[model samples]
Target chain A: MMLRQGALALAALALTAPGMAQDAVRSPDQIVAAAPARDWVTIAPQDLLVMTLAPDAEGNPRKVVIQLIGAPFSQGWVDNIRTLARDHYWDGMAILRVQDNYVAQWGQPDPGMGIAEKPVPEGLKRMSDADYTAGSPNWLTSSTLRATKEPQVIGDWPAPMLTDPYGDYATFREGWPIAGIQQMHIARQWPVHCYGMVGVGRGNPPDTGDGSQLYAVIGHAPRHLDRNLAVVGRVVEGIEHLSSLPRGKGPASYYADPAKRVPILSVRIAADLPESERPHLQYLSTESESFARYADARANRRDPFFVASAGGADICNIPVPIRAVAAE
Target chain B: MMLRQGALALAALALTAPGMAQDAVRSPDQIVAAAPARDWVTIAPQDLLVMTLAPDAEGNPRKVVIQLIGAPFSQGWVDNIRTLARDHYWDGMAILRVQDNYVAQWGQPDPGMGIAEKPVPEGLKRMSDADYTAGSPNWLTSSTLRATKEPQVIGDWPAPMLTDPYGDYATFREGWPIAGIQQMHIARQWPVHCYGMVGVGRGNPPDTGDGSQLYAVIGHAPRHLDRNLAVVGRVVEGIEHLSSLPRGKGPASYYADPAKRVPILSVRIAADLPESERPHLQYLSTESESFARYADARANRRDPFFVASAGGADICNIPVPIRAVAAE
Candidate 1:
């Protein structure tokens, strides 16, 4: 709650200075609380995946909600996943692996025996190596547009930033953390593999992922997976349900006994559900001025609890704030 | 199991090269399995903290094992902690906090109410800010001695390495990850705050910590706490028991309901226990050549599962392998 309060205060500041003379630096909670309603973007129901897990022996069904990244950002993977979910592809699928401090993956028990790959839907594109990079002119144009606006400053460091050799720049676009390399005219960007970020699991071949098997990061951000995996989106709500799963004990943290697996009840697009049953979720808009301050505060916490500021923050360490809107 | 296999293969490699042509790299399991008995250091019983947690509703007691760092490495804090446990100071203390993606702290519900501070034991010293740095000539001498040993090579990078701006070098001494600066004729080092690393929680004053409240990093490594906190040791075994606890929902992740708190059944020093009851444990020695290779392999994984090796690894990502020794 202190962190939440801090997050709100930070989100409220429009221009955060490293050591500016002020009564006190606003916390992220205060900043977010002071944000205008327009600064909160409602997640489209169609882009939301509501996964209801079968009740355990105790009879409590676990529900997890995911907010898919919008179009042109892992669009192919997202579309393919949405198609698979809509077709009831994962209704009976089980959470196969829950590696401690790693990932919790859900898919068919035997990949080859169950859930044969289906033809790629008409409009959904097959993801490839090129999909990993945002080298297209469109991304550069957007980055340029973002640069025209105020650049976020964390401590004394300005962002769209870079922690090089690791990545060229760490920036945000459409509410996703992007690690990018800026060349002469084009920028190559890809979604970072932060904790709670969801990705499609596949075999040795990069293109083999069809979204039938997916995993959510449950540990320290495995940034090496960046560009190597198709991170479709992030777990916006009910991440606790996913993170709290019993860690699997077999190879790659697969459940040794089939009976130990947690069964998936169903995964439905929020839009397909009745209006009354749909989740009204809103995320702090990355494009908003408030978010810039929020990100900075997270990078360099100036709170009383912190003795020294980290001076810089890793891309994965910064969590995007999300909340479910109350039903009218 | 696959990760273990990979670790084994990586560990078995006699000498790791960044991108050198080799038949294959050894996994940690293999390296450890093939190690000489002498390579495996039996944990001194005196330094082992055996924590028996109160039984769950089903009456299943959860046990956690912590191996305290040896003398001269948070010696004062560790000594204080040992004395407290010896006095049965935390017999009925409840685990007051279980912060999701942060830490699980166990101590008195009210800092001032339950366990009053005890007088310092005759031989145990109180820790201060000076203990935070390895600036002492003894440390510099040892660091100088360590510098003489061949530095570990991971890919093209060398260790005692530095992640930059954060620290001058990332090295290990006595099985603990250390972030240090190799200055002229002296080195300033401190144990890094990596996952599963245990630390003493204290008040606002830097010197206030006396090991009454202790916590383990349960999620991402909060590296900012490196020098600021007194890191006593690491959770050597049964960490899953700690990591899987129900997260508290109150401010700072404290359990909202007092009933929800898990009680500490008892804490015993292994050395004080009957010989038959003492835990049989061994840890891979950090000083060995095998560890150099192990550390390097972890930094740049050559496993088949990983397509691209993170050219460099952060200090936190490298986990020191530990195991329960087979009973004689």
Candidate 2:
């Protein structure tokens, strides 16, 4: 229905902030103030990947979860992912590469273990940084790979589609930056990639990323990847792990040693596992009233802890929160 | 004697770059290339923090080392830090806060539980982001903290420090765009706060960060803290452990539930430990001849890997390396 009516109809139903429904960018605080319960949706357990790491020498597991739901993530291979993340699967994994201000990647069981004998040229892992130059207003572009979507004008009319909004300035709907939750009126759609966002780690060499090797955005929101990479989920829990790999020693942070790789015991899709084995999960609905309040607190940060309000917020800077749902 | 005679000698050195030998903006590569052997100091193991996380439920003892040197982290605290790091003395610690685009920090073990807390206020905590923006660049005065230095003569006298070198063509030193390094050299030294940089985490009031709680920068370096905070060290490894923490549900990433604190087993000074216990250590000496070749390679990127060279470098973008050395 949203696709049929187009953006104009949906604009009226769209939210500018969490619960505030006035829908003006200028009045972010007021918009969430009026949102209804119809805005939020409960995330399905099947859509979740609760990542629990085995205890380090201290016997404390660094536990964090990811909610993977987009297209490719849900497409069949998720079961293998569950196995990979479960039971010390990534133990002694190798940190394949770490490109500065770009990514710090960790690969499965071993990367150098099965060498083809020849140093087959590592395929190009392209970054938008290659195309963009400082002081130039032009958008970054590349001929290498189309990882992000481009604006298209179809039949002389600008056409937009609905997508899951994770990063950038996604206004809250049901506690997630959801698309298509409102009255089916808007035709516009774009995906945002902000910090703490997670995308499947893939290799240009083909099928290199089985989702076992993953990464999180730690610096600025490398937003250009929204349409390009299969963003399976967001790091609902721990993201800092991928962000700080001590900047790597070699060209990329390809740690030269076998022992340097951070091990991943396993990754499990919540829905495939038994109830007792599942991770406790809960996320405030972006479309709900409570969530609007949360986004508000994060947007301007009017709390006593803040000495001054930043006044304006870039959608990337705003916080999207998730928590472990406790057993009743 | 060096400080007094250095002025005249620098006048002669200035002839190399912009008319002042001492006034040149030397890149890290250039700085290391030209620096005398005395300018580089071997990091004493006693000053290093051999941080080892206790075995998690799976029993992987994730071992890492952190070093605190220069000011604040001094020889006096050697014994104290040794106990804190090597012996599992300060285990099961708490993460103090997760500052956006900046840092994620963890505090020391509880006092009654057996560890002594560092009483200093968190280094470089913020009062407002505006201080970084339009508010008042001059508000730097009146504070007890000293200002960092950047020296360059505009028309034969030093000009104002420009943070952006390539974007702004800031002053040059030994062929590098420089500021704070010089400031610190003149005894007006301030901390260098960039990614993976470490500082103590503190409470409501700034300056409350003691050695007990530690933080590592996961995002853009918060340069605002250069002089305001006592930067203890930089993360040699395992910064992902800090950056990837599920952002605390509350503001500043303070996890609302105490149970969520990612535990820290201990933080120690590396130098105090026995040599046999050290991770075979080495670093791409910034001052080494090989680094000069590497920096040029980076500056021009003539390698087959890069089709086009960036032709420029950012201070924060430069990679400072640390390595595990194997004895010949």
Candidate 3:
């Protein structure tokens, strides 16, 4: 038995050798490397958020790029956030909380800390708890939406898709994992709280969120927050900056000392920035064949180093691939 | 229709109000707080690993407490590691790797860097690849074992259990989750790789691991490594010391600069330390009713703040609870 196991292991290793003729199973890396340019979708400048932070110790400004969820999904919140950036509402605001294995949030220390109170903008309505889900009437218009009652097979294993009894099926759409339920003939969807996904912060009442305060999940997927909180978007680049910050010390891991807070130098919409300063970011379209292959490869990795495939993958496990195009 | 949606949202919130008559689901925090003393298992000093690092910039020594997976599972690796610690083989050895969203590993830069290589100890035999599993003949001796093919119900939802067509069903055993398959009347089980779980790093071919190099999973649960690597234990406390380190720059995130490497002050078995210096640590027993309740609460949280429970939870979502005991 021992000899047989050893021989099997050796045979597996040989399949990965450079000169071997047999083609090994395509790993996620291999699948991604072979993808065509057309399989990638460029981010619309109007949907991009560029947040610049106070200089690091070495005097280099730290920047985080966020890609907002498209129309019919938290569009009101996204528009409000973009307006806030245009008005410089987030300038000088500090990242006040960095709870370990949770989130990093930033906003004014007080609601009116640095800016004067102003009338609520037109079309920027207070999002109620009902608006926090895809089941809402506003999200029923997307034609590409679909619902699944069973786990989707990716690669050779069943993907870790969940059928929530309380809501619509949780699945992926357009490179973003969304949770939604079907009402009548339409499917309503909201973005999930996966790592690096950004959400709007609020007080006791659900409708208080107005895009003034925002947070990004920095650790494990806090999926319970879905349908409860407004997940406005996801960080496309520079998540390491947010995740690597020193953990706060106060309740909910708020920075106890004022000096430790990381400050926001400026916040700008990609379209509003000078062409030279704007980032040319692109993401793997969920509809692309390469994406399907990539998702399957990730769900059941067949890399040489891995002895056994997990045969399953959770929604959070599949991070959408993004890359920055060099400015011409 | 909008009004009805609003009414339903309001009704959901009402269920969580303090005065509601229905028994609110017990949260994981509540279950843990209400646990009886018998539900807690004291750690044997001999099985405790105390790793002390050079003082941080603030002049306080960085200490990490690790709890070894008990007998018959990776015992050979454990014994060899303990012997290495006793010989001070790790003293001055640097933490060479800190891969972002992955692992932090530490040991000598090369074999025999700080200490001379010696003959393998009498009891510390080379563990074969087959020993990396619970289904092996050696692990079949444990009596407190059980196997399940169905998803375990944790709280109101089914736990995210995987049925690996290639190997065994992945589920929990004691507080530790395991991958096991039943043969005839007996079940075979082995420890799983979850966040904060420690593993023995080795070279090509499985038998080469002698426990000299060790790493802790500091990011996503790499379940694909299940039967591939030898996982010896987990970090019970001070994981922030490992997770918060600066990521290395070299391939696989190895520290490229020697000056940036964090140095190990000492590695000692708790039993070898003075009684006053030993950690008074205990973990919630997997066999305890409190543990079951805690697992359920984690899977489908009923906390007042959570608006909707994720009807399922992956293995990495359920962290084994541990606490330090006050000196008698």
Report the CA-based lDDT of candidate 2 relative to the real structure.
0.43
What DockQ do you compute for every candidate structure? 0.20, 0.07, 0.22
Q: Report the error of model 2 at residue B120, Å.
A: 9.2
- Model 2: residues with Cα > 4 Å off, grouped in runs: A1-40, A50-64, A69-111, A115-196, A204-213, A216-230, A237-268, A275-280, A285-296, A308-317, A326-328, B1-194, B205-214, B218-328
**Which digits, one per residue and each the tens of the lDDT, describe model 1 over residues A130-230?**
67655633333222321211124433223334232234346677787876655555556778887899998988778878777899988877776877788
Clash totals for all candidate models: 35, 93, 5
Compose the digit string of candidate 3's lDDT tens values, residues B192-283.
Answer: 77788999988767787888889998766666677778888998877778877777877678877666688898989999999999999888
Interface RMSD of each: 8.8, 15.8, 8.1
Poorest 10 consecutive residues by lDDT, candidate 2 chain B:
B140-149
lDDT of 2 by residue, A1-328 (tens): 1111231233433333332332323233343344343543445777777665545444756655677644322232344455554544554444455554566555443345442222212332333321111121122122111111111111211111121112111232223332111212212222344566665565543244455556666675554344334344577765555554445565445656545555556556677668887766555455444544444444334333333332223344445545555544
**Cα misplacement distance, residue B195 of candidate 2 (Å):** 3.5
If you score just chain A, what TM-score does every candidate get? 0.83, 0.58, 0.81
Each prediction's RMSD over C-alphas, in Å, is 7.7, 13.9, 8.2
Tens-digit per-residue lDDT, B200-240, candidate 1: 89777778888878998888777667667888988988777
Q: Model 1: how large is the Cα RMSD against the reference?
A: 7.7
Question: DockQ score of candidate 1?
Answer: 0.20
Instruction: State in Å the error of residue B296, model 1.
Output: 3.1
